[model samples]
Target: MNLLLIAALIITSIAVLAYIGSMVLQSWLYSVPADKMPLRSFVTALLAGGFLTLWCWIDTKNPGRYDTLFSFSSYDTEDFDVVDAVKKVGEEEKTIRYTRRSVGTKMVYMNDQNQPFRKADAEGAIFALIVTEKDKPVRFITKLDKNGNFPPGEIQYREEGGKRYIDDTMIGRVNRPGTLKVIYVLLLNFGHFLIWTLSLWLVMNYALGHAISIACCLWLVITLLIMPVLFTKTRKQEKVITPQVSFPSVNDPNLSEPEPKDEEKKGTRQFQDSNGNGIAILWIGSAISNS
Candidate 1:
């Protein structure tokens, strides 16, 4: 089904989107001066988060890289661990060892000699890994062995059964039943975006998309709706100019001199408001005729 190719495409798409989103978020935080966190702290935190996201993307696109890092080698059924119960009374302790065939958290890299090559284990559980050589699949198996030590590794099962060379038979280590490690490995292999189990729990109680939408709506409400309050709480009022008339004293000698008889009969107008607000309203008739 070319599942690996599909997985790669999905991982790449999400990674690019997340990277862009984080950049945008960082920019938005910078622009809001009132709600802004320290620039250095915000940048450092965001960079760390982005780096983790990038690693997750790489791991998804190339699952083999993580397998080589953590998934232990696959083993056969003959190596499955077994223990005899010593129960001589009622209510004995749980006995049978639980085993499941899946991908290993550790991966093996061969250095051209088909020998186990050294690689660091990713500090997390890994489920399935697709192994290939020259773009061809390899066969691997995960089964118990006679020694009671369940080790996962590449398998040569049914290689001589008229089958073409394939490496798709590798199996991962068996995890203990009802253990966090087991659950962690299983969830990691789900190949979906990893988040808190509590979120998944909420999704169980409520629909995933609905829960996600609610979260987004809450975020918007906080960011957009509360911005005014934030600004009001953090801001100081600035003084702004309100225009009013200012009169300048006239010192012309003509103002002090007596007028001629004909002009004396014409009365001069005084600009004033009966309300006594000290705002002068110009007597414009004289000014217009003069202009």
Candidate 2:
């Protein structure tokens, strides 16, 4: 019903669509085998999830909620400059100039042509933006999050001249301390980069714990040592089970042959039984015995 809500829903739907499309493409492009299904499916799902998250971000103007795209990109100079670089309408020959000014002991403002840039052509201009602080700059700056949200600050931008003086503000946000927190806040909305760092750290910590945990580490070491013993035992059993027909006697019952008296004597006095064609027998008897 609401415009913003509708926009959000649309964006979410598009994201889902993109994700499914990517999966279909992946399957069709590569003839993945069944054994590798889990790995391939995981990759496809992750990509789809990322797209869906990006869709939500575009719609909601918030990328923090989705882990998929949380670390996708980062807050670069472009993101920082978008709001600060406000251009004056109908000033092609004259380049718009802006200089930061301290309005009072606790208030500071940017002056455009030696005046506070308040009466912007809200309708005719592409955008009008101003930064406002709830507290003094020194105190507010300390409290500002890297994501560019001050404790309570306002960005007054005119999308169209005479539209409205309504300001965009982020209110009651807690101050994030230190450079790390500030950087995190700024990149908080950057879907991929922020998430990657967080995920990597979490995974590393988990892996380290597994490697260092007393019980688990001991179990791993024991298992590694035991594996070679088990393997050797298995090989020995296999060798023993395999039939060994070493030095089999010529007269053995398992050896098939015609009548012994009918056998022919070779030049070396060895008897040859023609009927013992397929028998794997070893003749250990002396040639003179039959003679």
lDDT tens readout by residue for model 2, 41-151: 344335433533444444344322222222323221111111233433454412233444556653333345564433234423313343234432211112224432334
Question: TM-score per candidate, in order?
Answer: 0.17, 0.19
* Clash number for candidate 1: 40
Per-residue CA lDDT of candidate 1, range 1-291, in tens?
A: 233443344345434543454345535644432222233323433442333344344444543223211351232122222211111122332221122323376443333334332111222111122234355533322233544233466533232222332232222222222344345434443322223222322322224554355345433443344323332332344668899996655886655757657544443222233433333334455567789
What global local distance difference test value does model 2 have? 0.35
C-alpha lDDT of candidate 1 relative to the true structure: 0.34
Cα error, residue 3 of model 2, in Å, equals 8.8
Cα TM-score of candidate 2: 0.19
| Residue 77, model 2: Cα distance from true site in angstroms | 16
C-alpha positional error of residue 225 in candidate 2 after TM-score superposition, expressed in Å: 56
Maximum-TM-score candidate: 2
